[model samples]
Target: MGKLTIVAHIKAKADKIDLVKSELLKLINTTRAESGCINYNLHQDNSNPAHFLFYENWESRSLWQTHMNNKHLEDYMKATEGAVDEFVLNEMAEIDS
Candidate 1:
């Protein structure tokens, strides 16, 4: 099995930027501790404060799937219900070199 990479772009509603950011930040610590997590980093766009991106690497697709079902993620989903304006998730596999 090969490693998987995930690029997630999140945009918070204008009025809920702060609340959405706080909720997203909470996923960092917990996600980093999960099994098979190689690296999970979050970034905020300087020009657009409400725009955020997450770059993640996983040992395998299954492990990444497990992460999606994690309790904290579910909680985040619930907590940010309408606060998010757009969410784009992309999964990729490295090409043989």
Candidate 2:
């Protein structure tokens, strides 16, 4: 298996933006410390405060999967249950030139 790149977009409910952003921020430190995590960065849209993006790179898809199943992720889900309006995730392989 090769490196995996994940692009995740999260849009918070208008009224729940703060809550969702906090919960999403909580994932950073822990996720960055996880094995095989090369990088995990969070971004908020300049014009849209409720929009968030997570740009991540992992050593492998399996390790990324492991990270997905971690307790913190589950906690994040529980914490932001109804706070999110839209979520999209994309997994890709870097094209080598």
lDDT of 1 at 84: 96
What TM-score would candidate 1 get against the native?
0.95
| Per-residue alpha-carbon lDDT of candidate 1 for residues 1-97, written as tens digits (9 for 90 to 100) | 7899999999999999999999999999999999999999999999999999999999999999999999999999999999999999999877865
Candidate 1 lDDT (Cα, 0 to 1) = 0.96
For residues 1-97, write the lDDT of model 2, one tens digit per residue.
7999999999999999999999999999999999999999999999999999999999999999999999999999999998999999999899982
Candidate 2 CA-lDDT value: 0.97
Best by TM-score: 2
